[model samples]
Target: MKRSLRRALWAGAVVAVTVAAVPVTTAFGAGTVTTTFTKAQDWGTGHETRVTVTNGSSATVTTWRIEFDLPSGTTISSAWDADVTSSGNHYVAVKKSWAGGLAPGASFSWGYNGSGAYKAPLNCTINGAACGGGTTPPTTTPPTTTPPTTTPPTTPPPTTPPPTTPPPNTGGKKVVGYFAEWGVYARNYHVKNIQTSGSAAKLTHILYAFGNTTGGRCSIGDSYADYEKAYTAADSVDGVADTWDQPLRGSFNQLRKLKQLNPHLKVIWSFGGWTWSGGFTQAAQNPAAFAESCYNLVEDPRWSDVFDGIDVDWEYPNACGLSCDTSGPNAFKNVISALRSKFGSNALVTAAITADGSNGGKIDATDYAGAIGNLNWLMPMTYDYFGAFNAQGPTAPHSPLTSYTGIPQQGFNSDAAIQKLKSKGVPASKLLLGIGFYGRGWTGVTQAAPGGSATGAAPGTYEAGIEDYKVLKNTCPATGTIAGTAYAKCGSNWWSYDTPSTINGKMTYANNQGLGGAFFWELSGDTSNGELIGAIKGGLG
Candidate 1:
């Protein structure tokens, strides 16, 4: 999923929409506390915001406060993770009552809704220190130790950490992962992490997501991010700096280098996500033309060697996603047929479709079976069946593998969708099960069991309702298992996600069902050591 689409996919319509923020650091006291303000969502007249506080100093901080002034015509409305008091356009926020002290290198974040378009907070101060880290007298002492010397590379580095374990076994199955283009932004996750985390050694294919479909043609999403930004010598994948006039740079160059390191990996360009699905209806109108345009874009001479083929992730054909699609049942099959015809049998032709298994749901609205002959593999997004999108929660696992007595919705689990597609004649060998590397959670919950009540979305470093599995593993470890998944209740926050054990169980089920393989939503969500993907490989073996 792309940035906006992932936000919307798990958080729902109103919660979708996010842009990267340039972090602002505060200087003055012993512990330098930095604050970053990000526009989580913007809707013309109003926007939601998140403020992150990072402690870079040696000492631990028991408490903190932030003060900022909004420009005229803008004001604060609602807030989370902090208590706010406003005087005209100026607002002061104190740490939330339930929050604990911040340790060195630790971070805390709070958010609010404000009027007018998203704007940077002016005259910002964190714990009485200038947010921009000006040369001010010591109000408090900060940073007892010298700052770390190495800065993370903007581009992938040439070095690869030795594998901590033996090479992963996929058992002739594919371990596909999606790498979001925008992850190089605020996420600070570059292709280098894939190598260092040992994921590159495990992955059989990497799907580069969201090459835009605009004007009914395949287009680049961000030119600078895709192939324009230059990489320094230290950040270059081959340890050679990007030239001023290189034909390719940015992520394209980095991926090309990554492919060199892992010859077994195939990269596929995936277009159309929740935010961009609206364009599919138009592309579906002329499947042959659409396929031709995509063919040209994928085989562009500049990066022709970087990709194997294409994967169309149109949200839905005759069904609904972020927006409803009225394209008849033939639209999807027609598009796939045209793509296979153009790309030929040598290239990989795949797709990602809805896992809705209800009778007459999205699965029943399209001609998925007809496209089988033309496609190499089809992925059923088995996750996101339920989330904090509905604020009041009956607290359920988001990616339940099987049905339970109190499942909120019938036929919403992973097994139901897989079985439904199999019944429709979609060969198990051509169907890959989808797993989300993140978790969906809610706050203000009173119970610990699956059935519980929640007031709203749980606070997250990036978005409200969702968080990466890497953070969730350490912050809120799972307490119990249910429906072949895991759930945890830490303090008042409740989260549901698949643990390594659960993923192992799921993978066993996948192998037993004679399925093709298992693919995750993306790679950035896994631990720095690639724990989850390791489980996937181990279980598949």
Candidate 2:
């Protein structure tokens, strides 16, 4: 699940129109510019907008600015592609240094989130000249009908028929789990636990939770924990002693030994998690260079044997996560294409993507289906759809397989995401369902069922409002079930999470949906006896 601090921005249907171009001759320069305002999405109180500035002049544009006025009550929340500032009802957007100097006939766009009803901006101007040739007529009609009930087709139909049979479920079905690099710290979860807990025997692959994206290249998140720290035989995977002069002695070496015990296990180094995702924006600028850097780092001679492939866990592409990204829709496809080109066809390349199934949501923000050809599989982060992020009342299940009445947001469940992706031409066999090993809850709740009021985040060992299943199982025993998940109310606190039984149901849904497999967030959350992992393996079988 996503742990970044960002407000839940619901997706809505997009309505795009090409406003007529207007020629503006100014003392600064003479150019023909057109401003296209696209109502990208609107979820009642909040909406998203995309504005494109086109240069029709013969000369190149070095610097540009746009000015507009919002409706009486509307206000901008967040923006991308340009530096935006507002005063009273006026908003000014200036091109970012990176986006400056547009060649003739070129175009650049920026998007933003706004409050209140959607309204066309007034007095639109580009380079101090009238926009779209004239002022945009005021829009009184409400933003296009509520977000569409279904996701409109984004990709064209394939020229050839899709395979009639599902991809071979090699070795039954894939059971993937993440191994966090930082877990060896206060969490004390070492690679050796995967073996002692019996998870290795049942797992198909292990995703080493993160390599970093820094300076537009693949870098180490924690050098000491990743490969420098020494582990004794007691804590090592192969009961091997680490010599003082050894070049590699940390988790990377331990993973290498784990593969010896479980040959079927494949390890993939994932990059750009919530904390490290900011660099992806820079990477998208030059995907080939980024891919080359990743190839070199993953196959770094020292521990090349440890990693089977690369997994890009970009919190999101062409959308907002920890930081806003304005790389446009093809950014993700371009990056994956470069990775596939550099890594070659034999290496396993995958990605963990957003599960925002809402109309015009993150799913529409990128060309995911177009990139699937280069990927071994795509994991939709179906959990973390809802959490204590909205600290107020109206609590709901965080990872629901299906939607139910009074759901906090529409199209936020796992099923909705899966259906949307399939509709967008992503083969069911290439998609993996995501499961969370922890639970989200609230404190001071009076009612037992969801939608109850809460004082604030529930107390947790590491962070407020979140607790691992290992602790949640005993701390807050299951009291009932809702939306294909488990919930419990112990004292004034109310918690909602998934259990073995719920995972069984989710796995059954995955089979029915013809999904490739199921993958969970991390390994440390399960009990020492591998209770949850057992359920996953048993259910997949």
Per-model lDDT: 0.74, 0.74
- Residue 374 local lDDT, model 2: 65
Estimate, for each residue in 117-186, the C-alpha lDDT of model 2 and write its tens digit: 5667776777886644233322321223111112111211111101111122343467899999988998
TM-score of 2: 0.71
* TM-scores of the candidates in the order shown: 0.70, 0.71
lDDT of 2: 0.74
Per-residue lDDT of 253 in model 2 = 87
**How much lDDT does candidate 1 score?**
0.74
Instruction: Return model 2's CA RMSD, one decimal.
Output: 15.6
The sequence of per-residue lDDT tens digits that candidate 1 reaches over residues 141-197 is 444432221211211110110111111234556788999988888997777788889
* Count of steric clashes across candidates, in order: 10, 0
